[model samples]
Target: MSSTRQFSFEFFPTKTDAGHEKLMQTAAHLATYNPNYFSCTYGAGGSTRDRTIDTVKHLNDVIKVSTAPHLSCVGDTKADLRQLLTMYKNSGINRLVALRGDLPSGMGMASGELRYANELVEFVRKETDDHFTIAVAAYPEMHPQARNFEEDLRNFATKVKAGANIAITQYFFNADCYFYFVERVRKLGIEIPIVPGIMPITNYTRLARFSDACGAEMPRWVRKQLEAYGDDTKSIKAFGEQVISEMCERLLQGGAPGLHFYTLNQAEPSLAIWENLKLPR
Candidate 1:
């Protein structure tokens, strides 16, 4: 994954050796398509700390793809963040996904030095200057915690102002939501690329659970159609591919900068959509 690609993939750090092998195999397969980079997710409050560092390094070093490790400030100290930033910098990692992250369960409320994403973005910029390209999250359908759309937009604008280099949106079924969100963000005078986060539709039940938790709307028609497929994995996947692929085509045609896929550490679903789009390899 390299050379200025308009698409990229995301994976989570595996906790087991076999899982690691599968992820590596997936990365190797996706690498042939030339993603901009392979991004590995970080767990809340640094829960998956070491695995994330090790996984990111392996993907970059073994798979030879540029990797971006997600860094969140939900339950970390300034010193904790500073040390990790220094470690990554020393390792030749040049990009990061800066997030406020979810509050790890059993934590009453956020107790981190940096409570919000803008603060984290500012901290990263202050600590490392322009050394790393920082990507912040964008909620097309509004963050579940956001009071209203206006407040969410303002928060996003603040994060951008705090030195975020780019934004990757939460996955949505509606292209109109992405377009409208981008339009609103642009009205605030922020011009960084807002890449739409794509979740390949593999399992409907899991997708439903994830969407419910993340505030991503699964359109009623889409839900009903998926419901009709009931336990038929093949039909579910085929339908998912069609719907997601068509929406992706509309998004690209409507002027999205690029697509960032939440690959779930698998290659087939994403590759199915990629082939559907006939996207440059």
Candidate 2:
């Protein structure tokens, strides 16, 4: 568990004054751990485009953290995306997470030239020349749209071939899913680091909603904890730390190259998990 491994964090853009303060504080607190990189997420349906850019700039320039801003293919034209690439380039931010984001409710499905992450990755490559290192998302438990698990893995291969340097998977509770996915991808010749994303769950019902949407499976032990401790914050926090700590230990034992925490803009829980891992500063 104490082995030297890469770590990164993901944060979302803030739209309100209070949220901005929270985002900054989260960035500052997490910065103390010296993560390998920090990423800012793009909102669904273009809701937080400006804030995404602003956050990336602030973190890179003011916070002095190496930042990767997520660029989504939702509700954006190629020209608009290119302009964002230029902005990131100018800011000395050379990394990106290309994603086909969630469509707006009632839109059925998103409409654009960049319909898939592979398309977005290809667009970035054609727009820049070795200037940007790109990462793409992976789904261990088959994406909702994929025809099957094989199709999902093939799609992942397409992203790697398209120009992805790293693949950060959607969060899941089972470590076996991640290990098996990585093994299968390696067998197929995809060599990039496939980092396991860990979610620190403090509430059962809320997590159920997210799990349903994202295809994450919650173990029965976790479910029991949530059922037993429902809204009690102290109990929830303690349970979250235990679950995540055990998961990280298993992931490390299974040879995961790194761990990426979905901090959800909070500090104490993620910080506590890191402390439990005794990770290097």
Identify the candidate with maximal lDDT.
Answer: 1
Largest TM-score belongs to which candidate? 1
User: What is the C-alpha local distance difference test score of each model?
Assistant: 0.92, 0.86
Q: Which ranges in model 1 have alpha carbons more than 4 Å from their true place?
A: 1-5
Give lDDT tens digits, candidate 1, residues 85-177: 999999989989999998888986787898998999999999999999999999999999999999999999999999998899999999999
- Cα lDDT of model 2 by residue, 1-281, tens digit: 23457788888887798998888988998898888888889888777898998899988888788999988898889988889899889889988988998888876778666888899999999999779889899888878778899989999999899989988889988888888999899988999988888888777788888898888878888888778886797888788888888888899888888888888888777788888988888
Q: RMSD of model 2, in Å?
A: 1.7
Candidate 2 regions with alpha-carbon error over 4 angstroms:
1-4
Q: On a 0 to 100 scale, what is the lDDT of residue 234 in model 1?
A: 96
lDDT of 2: 0.86
The per-prediction tally of clashing pairs is 0, 0
